[model samples]
Target: MQAKSRALHEFGATFLGPALHVYAEAIESSGADHLPVCLAREGWCFHRLLKRLQRDHAIDLPRDPVYLRVSRTLLFRAMLGSETITRMALGNDFSGSVLDLMRKRFGLQLHEIFSALPIELLRFNCELPKDKDTVFEWLSPHLKALTTVVSPTRRALTAYLERSGLTDPHVRPLMLDLGYSGTIQKILTHTLKRDTSGLYFIATKPGETAVGDHQALLKGVFHEGVGWRSGCTMLDRSLLFECLLTAPHGQMVDMRQKSNGEFEYFYGREAATQRHFQDLKTVFDGAIDHVIMCRRHGVTYTRGDVQDLYEVFATKPNCIPHDVWHLFNVDDDIAGNGMINPMQMFAI
Candidate 1:
């Protein structure tokens, strides 16, 4: 437990050092008018920590960062009203059963999926071809029918965004998240029909290309390039980071407007169960404390320094506690990837 705590503290400082510097500069240049919004799930921790830092005089901001409850599923579903489904939204090189593909990628409920897909497709558990072109070719016939089902979600999401002040033309938003791919940022830019700035911890080379036209809008504070080539191995272990840096709540899957003119958010199953809650809380608390201490002590870390710390934490056997390995049941239901254990990658 102590070893895990210490490692997480280093993790916190390494990532936070770059974040604080970038955040201060962004706020300074964007002026007091732009709002900083944290993308939810992972950004929940960042928003809370930033607020605490601001209160403690460790960081200064003109206003509090807003916690935006958004997920890839919700954003993709929302965009179905206007945009065609792309390989990026459906997961590049996706390998899953047809049912899995429809449910996960389209964010379709069981009934909607059943009605849209042919009966034969549902009867057999057919795996999708991993090739990008093959999958899209197969999906071409069903695209219009599938997208038509979720059109209402797009309308409701627009209302929700307007309510959140995201759609206000005068208010520029700085989207914050722990990043590899800037998918959320890209979707927002497309859906909102406006340019958006995304501030991430790290953006990979592949992510830059994946973001397409919105690529220029993204800035990676810590490091931006191919992970192994650049020695930012931490970027490759995003699942582990997600495990450590997630919000206490479940992932937001859907949102709807009430008759009373209010928005309601619907969340999927909790990623981390109750049994693991206390352990996660301890690690998160320690990390936040470490960031605050570093800020107060005038200590800062570089990308290289963070890389070195991550290498030790990831490669050194028994450096992480035995119980910590069990804490890797992260649910990627939104992505249709299912539950994955990050530690399994090390076994290979």
Candidate 2:
């Protein structure tokens, strides 16, 4: 039945122009409400990961679910209690939009010279903390004002959960992201106070000390393998694909309070950020179109099919047109990360 429906849709696209997008639209919409409210990490890579999760993992998500953009700042601040928030604020030299907001809105610039700044919130709060009392003492005075933003953000998020039906005990929404380690999921679960499950495109298991019980439930689709596996290595070596699958947005830097007593979300932005977003979206759409074209002729995508596709990309990247390649080659964090390089992973 599914195949027949898909065939008809493909037939529509062949003769018709953009009018046939309804079939693609239907495919995109099918399991959106049925599946968990997938919260993808806000980055350029997760878009490809989202495709895999939909096609391979059998998870139905809306076409570019906006709720998935729970940025690192939003998650960390929401999950951290007043104490931890205070500690991090005191222990670090705040910068960027967050710094500006804290200074202008709250008149706060609490810092310590010798103490290590809390560079990564998860690591600082969960893994390392040298002096708790000192952090508390330094930032105690400003805790109330800081929470003005964090608290409202949490309330807004809570409302979002309620609106999305994720808060329902019966619904188990999967958190999707590109993971080196599963810190974001941990903090997200802690913040939501829910037993979350996640699908990471590629990830290593967190150490025993990692936050939240969701770690055990974390599954990787294109995970780092235990031994040398040709398919896995080929997929990993496909740097263009890895770079192509990313969030077009910057990290959510701060939550701002309005005069009317509401909260607004703030994400780190650059002059070229919107342009970068548009380019990545173009690549993502092209990838999905390719998948749709293959399926049009009954060429169903299996796990092996995906592996073959990755190998093709890795070995013969020039197969992609110069225009598309230009879009995929944008300078992004995932490109600089060591994962972009090809590696020999075949076992001798």
What are the RMSDs of all candidates, in order? 3.9, 10.3
Q: Write the residue-wise lDDT of candidate 2 on 202-308 in tens digits.
A: 55653332334333246555454322344464334534443444455544544545667555766543323234566555444544454455445444444444455
Instruction: Name the candidate that leads on lDDT.
Output: 1
Across 1-348, the per-residue lDDT of candidate 1 in tens digits comes to: 577666544544543444444444444455566678789777877787778778888766766778888888788766653333355665543456767766776567899888777876655443333454555665678778776787667778888777777787876777888886677877877767666777777766423333434332677766776554454567766566676667666677778888998888877776653346666666556667776776677766665666666676666666665645655667877545677777776652
Clashing pairs in 1: none
Per-prediction TM-score: 0.82, 0.54
Model 1, runs deviating above 4 Å: 1-33, 81-87, 120-130, 206-216, 227-231, 273-275, 322-326, 334-336
Give the alpha-carbon lDDT of every model.
Answer: 0.66, 0.43
Sequence-dependent TM-score of model 2: 0.54
Error of 2 at 2 (Å): 34
Q: Candidate 2's error at 104, in angstroms?
A: 18
- Total clashing residue pairs per candidate? 0, 8
